[model samples]
Target: MVKIKANYVLAALWITLLCSCQKRSPEIPEIRQVDVLIVGGGASGTMAAIQAARMGSSVLVAEETPWLGGMLTAAGVSAIDGNYKLQSGLWEEFRKNLYNHYGGPEGVKTGWVSNVLFEPEVGDSILKYMAGLEDGIELMLNSTLGHIEKTQKGWIADIAYQTDTIRVETQVVIDGTELGDVAALVGIPYEIGMDSRHLSNEKIAPETANDIVQDLTYVAILKDYGKGTDMTITKPEGYDPSPFYCTCAGRCNQDSIGRKLWDCEHMMGYGRLPGDKYMINWPIFGNDFYLNVIEMAPHERKQAYEQAKWYTMCYVYYLQDALGFRHLGIADDVFPTADGLPFIPYHRESRRIDGIVRFDLNDLARPFAQTNALYRTGVAVGDYPVDHHHAAYPQSEALPDLHFYPVPSYALPLGTLIPKSVSNFIVAEKSISVTNLVNGTTRLQPVCLLIGQAAGALAALAVDEGVSPADVPVRKVQQALLDSKAYILPYLDVSPTSSSFSAIQKTGATGILRGEGKNIGWENQTLFYPDSLVSKSALQTGLQDIAAGLVITSKKETLTVNEALKVIYDLMKLRPGDTHFSSREAMDEKAKEIWKNHMDTLMDPEVSITRAMFSVLLGELIDPFSNWPVDHHGTYRSGIN
Candidate 1:
């Protein structure tokens, strides 16, 4: 045999490997099916899964990371933003549970940046525990979406779990990922970076679309080192010292509004958390990544993430060696990484979908409630200011035009969650269709959580109704959310803690919703008596307290259905000879005309009324707005305006 030269042998091996790669077969993905499939396990994804599971649907939650909380835990942005007192539904439950965990609400206010604060690990554990209690939810950590295809049965998504691949079929799919990855992978039309001023009609938007987005930060947790401690951080390779612009205490040192004095400060910013730990998320001096992570290849994205961590490491080095804060060090137990840093970046923007309804600056300007029909369908509420973080990065020339302003407490419409062309899909969190200016406030943690909860509820309702998410009636979704004890309107004083809150919330448009209950003489004190079985006598008394004309002198224990109908007819001044009455055998043309113009229904003669019926009847009679009450056989039907 003739021996080949070393170079020739190496070249032959490389050619063989290339040919073998081209001939290899693609791997097959395993299949699994569920009623609802959620692609992210961040703040919104967790809430989406919980709500869907709560609605008797089998939910599959696939998270890329092991921990649950997104910005709050893995990203280490533990400071909760906006809607502190307006917490409703699952959010209220979360706050209550957090309070109980910390022993009281006072204990949760451990930091100055937010009214409520807790350790990142504490929040992560709480979310995990809550998900664990739901039997319908199957959570798969360390899994990521690979490829998604739409099907007649809804949709199927290929998920990658390290070396293994699984295909998931779902009736409803919610895109709650931090960066809107599901929407992008499924071919949904979406926008990345800043939108145009004319397109979104937002005053703060630029004239044209810019690839610049809000800067992301690799937040760090610093523990108090004893006095005179001398720990030093090594300088990271390829670090840019010119970008660092902040002193340690940026919060108190800088101006509160408009452009800040400097990017960094010398004092601890945003105050501290419990256990003597300080959160270092100051935008001025902190390590903020100005590059766009969306639409990046895997290797490019990984390199960007590494750059962010390296920048933060450089900042830590500055804090300890340069700033003379030798006493401060990275929290040893906060994160599992080698240097004890957070696992991910706190992302501020995502690939926003082209939704059925687009929220703009005008929607957040307070007058859109009456002018826009979609605005009336308020599903989530937020009150955060429009915050943009572009001044810190010099390379992001287009981002400096963004400015902050106070946004009114506004409701997000259900249309924002529904995509324009996609079926059986919903996008929550920062992915919802809104202008860049509106996203400033809507991207807050509280609003995102509510959106996630509503998305889940909407998905569950769609699955149950055998309809697409877009086909579900807005009012029905609102009613389902209301029934779930969600606070649609923030004007109400009573929360879910009130016994009759759900009933009162549902009847708000009918002008029958009341605050504290009126005192009935029989009761020990004034109360709604929501749970007590109501009798006819009690309803008559309630009617007297509400309607001035529907007074009944004879108080019977339980009046027959006929008596109730007769009482309502008498109050409306209708007589038996009227065409509405079955006794009108020889009604004249004029009498028939009167009955035709004012249609009403009559109830059964002998059945007793329930408490719900009594409340409805009482509400119709005492119309504060002086609107006509449509009578469906004396069944308290609300009249059309």
Candidate 2:
């Protein structure tokens, strides 16, 4: 009996040891090394990742939210604000995908405020699909940046991804966060809220600066469920309908006569999305909430966002109970949250970094006439008017009338993406170096996309060339963007589809040929009249900067083919080449040979040369832009200066 009991004890101890060995230990955090580390998976961050990956660099995107499209998708601001006609780069690709999904452009034009409107989930899915197609991108959803340390070789960042912390070592770090959090973490200098007139040098700017940013909105997607469905949500805490009474049925000063200018139906139809839904992001006495949570802690920000969400819920209640639209409720199938609200609030402004160059109102109003020629270093373009939302502020009435400041379509300089103090860093989204006034326009959807794309290209080029972002040649970055079908010059007339697009772009960058910019109502323009005849004085003005001794002997106003050949001969003298013709006849003979080899049509020496023809010839022959390198301030470093 004692021997059997001892055997039983031995068997029990062995079983216990086996059970202890089978138990799992705590998981260790992973350490990932990548060429480019994008901090946020927002609009610009996602574009930056895709662009960097497409440029043959391994990229990792850390997005706090599960979705990618920040304002366009997660924030539920589905209606595109601008860039309806200026679809370039990834923005054009994303828009085309949207058109494909919705059947056509006509299918998504369900809103009166914008030409394009779709469900937020659809935008998120499209972005995910676009990002997924790139093999070089690795996306970490539900990830938040923890600690960032700049090393001698690159940057090391600790990102809280899902249930574990991930250490990422990258050569380039892109701050694509909605609020520029990564830049702030690295102790980079940035500006918040308004800039004084003395600082910004805008005639309309206020004398004193303040911490007053644009009102952010927590957009909610409401769907129409039938008249008798009773889709109205439960009354929110501290719900009051009195504040929003004036939103739909009230007499305002804008109306010359004392009359109700707006109705509930018209207000709802303003943001009506496809498939019988509403965006619920109205501005005037609507859901635009006043809060600056940029400096708040994570928990503090969440608490603040809850207040904004409740305020939006209050407005929704007002829409249903007071306005008699009881059938419209929060769209249950839109978001992954327990509540039907968007994943994040629509932030209209962010901490603007102090970059190598500061893009201001003057840059937009008169791009070509700037002191530094900032237009020559453009990487992204925007045409939206300076639209600000400050109705929620008490001193909003004292602010300058931004609507009076009309600006032509302008290109954002590449220097705006490179921080002056930080190395190997690029800022995208709304955090670029632009004045508060310019941010109102650059903060739009399409411009942010292009800006993100440019940031990606700059980061990728810096990694591939083994140089800092600031050290990368501005022309090289611009050329890469052009190759990606992006606009370095905001020329409305000449598009990426044009055969002479690259040539015109290169020539325009060199200031050898300039476009005329105009501000017509809401549609700003920079027209490059490709078919117009090249004038002698215009050519002389353009060539004076590159070719110092070139003189136009032709007495006619418009330059002919013979005169153009002589000018090309003079230009050839400045650049080193074997085809340095001794006389106009010899130059013409060489030009004919070159034209036959390059261009399709026969060379005619009698016909007047058009702007397009001259640009193509200059691109093929001299390629002057390659020789001239512009500095951070857009000043030419070598020839022109």
Candidate 3:
């Protein structure tokens, strides 16, 4: 009888243990639905989330690192590069915040390498503050994405955060991850490293394609502790000072009157940040390490990153031991890492997606002459020249001299952000579809921020309209960017603060009054010449492209107010078949009715119309961009006229 009771007790104990194990198996992670799920909260990803949230889309940003900014903060490249005169949208907002934090523009200009420089921590705090203001954004730091699949409605992804797995159902996905990891995870076709001349048709590209990416820098931020401080760290492994001997040797600057400013002080001041901090990211012979970790597994990448970190530590030791700058020590309070280095490396290249349109060097060299008017669909702009760091590679000698091909300031096309096959995917970071040559300019911080803003707008519009990102109207995206004080056209003279900013942007995108671009020194310029007079031929040519079957009877060389008004009347009557305006008299009366709506001054019929006035009149009245619909390639669709 006692043996029978023992058997029953053992059976009951087994049943209880089994039930407990089943209960603790981690209940399949509750589904969290969002309108947009942005992977990687880097520079572009952060801007994308904020922009999407502002557009009324519930956004979830999954970042692998704890900090928000990628290269700008987490990677410790806090010095701003390019787009100095072309501050638009979130870039401008971020800069203004820096100015406020540091007491103005002059305060942050402690470094000679860039006009804007700050500590990485400050940049992160500002970005976090900016993101916090938006209520729709759910930023998950130290989070990673896993197991994403496309569904008929949208996408479903599993996000791992703090020992918990959260399933996300998102309408649109933005690949803002460093090295384009999210796109790679989703099986998006992408190209890495150098492209052959035949592939890109770029004059500067090498004849043969190779998997040679730019050298990544493991940045170290050093602070001036005190005059007699001995903050020198122990010597790192492989501490040969031969590779760094030429680091202080100045580089040849073609823009600086062909002078090479060689000095140790100049090298130290290159990335000098505010508050007596130094950004040790010297590219020449410094800490730029060559490693393509894009395709590596997580553990493999972690191991490779350790080597890069050691290489940077060697450089830091060289500065202290050899150069005798012992007062400057690693900024311990900057990052949370144990080694006092950045959370990530400053990746200069990524997996360039095979997007709907592939931007090349030819597009930047000649924007208006392209077979497809890609410039018309521009969503982001960059002015930085084509810069590549290949000193570490032996094969770099076979490549063409990139500095020989000077490109003007250019805008990035909207199609470059949308993958050709992905339904609702958008690429925001350095991974956007561009030739290896063009990625040099687009990969900068300011351009990446603007690209992120554009990506957010595209994703939000796609979710709101229940359409794919490729199907969203090009002009609608541009309009949304302009509404947010961003630039679609790279007009150096006309800033976002101008009252006629939207007017000029709309007209410029329509290819009506084109801006002239110039590559003078490092500062590339595209001037609208708002004060210049609008010639009759230019006006007629622009009108013909949009308003088909319209006749202009103007004989004068330049267009006056009366002549411009006549052309507008003719275009109105031809297209949309405006029955409200029977003749020039009726059209003029209607124009007068809406004159106060667009202009601040009274009507002056005899005054010659300037380019600015003409753009304003046509952009407000005709609205050619609205009627002209464009495809993903920026080519006009048929049957629109």
TM-score (C-alpha, index-matched) for candidate 1: 0.74
Between candidates 1 and 2, the lDDT winner = 2
- For all predictions, the C-alpha RMSD in Å is 14.0, 9.8, 10.1
1-641 in candidate 3: lDDT tens per residue? 33433443354344224322312124578578999999998999999999999999999888898778899999999999999999799999999988877778998999988999998987887787788778798777787888899999889999887667789999999998889988888889999999999978886688899889988999999999988999999988668888777676443343442324358777799999988999998876789988999999988999999988998999999889888899999998889888889999999999999999999999888987778789899999989888887766656566666652567888899999999988989998999999999988999999999999999999999989999998888888998999999999899999888878888888888887788889998888899988899887776676655665666676778888888887776666656543345677866665666566657567778878888877777766667676667766667665453
Query: What TM-score does each of the candidates earn?
Result: 0.74, 0.92, 0.92
**Weakest ten-residue segment in model 2 by summed lDDT:** 17-26
What TM-score does model 3 achieve against the real structure? 0.92
Judged by whole-model lDDT over C-alpha atoms, candidate 2 comes out at 0.85
Alpha carbon lDDT of each predicted model: 0.67, 0.85, 0.84
Candidate 2 stretches greater than 4 Å from native: 1-27, 249-253, 256-261, 576-590, 593-600, 639-641
| Backbone clash numbers for all candidates listed | 17, 0, 0
Q: Where is model 3 more than 4 Å wrong at Cα? A: 1-25, 250-261, 547-552, 577-582, 593-599, 638-641
1-641, model 2: which lDDT tens digit per residue? 33433443354344224322322222765788999999888889989999999999999998888788899999999999878888689999999878877778998999888999988987887787787778888887777898899999789998776567788999999999999999999988999999999989987777999889999999999999987888878998789876686686553444643234466678788999988999999987789999999888889999999989999999999888878789999998888798889999999999999999999998888876777788889899888889988877777778876653578888899999989998989999999999999999999999999999999999999999998899898998999999999999888888899888888888888887888888898888888899999988888887766676888899899988878877877777766543445666765676777667656778988889899888887776656777666787766665432
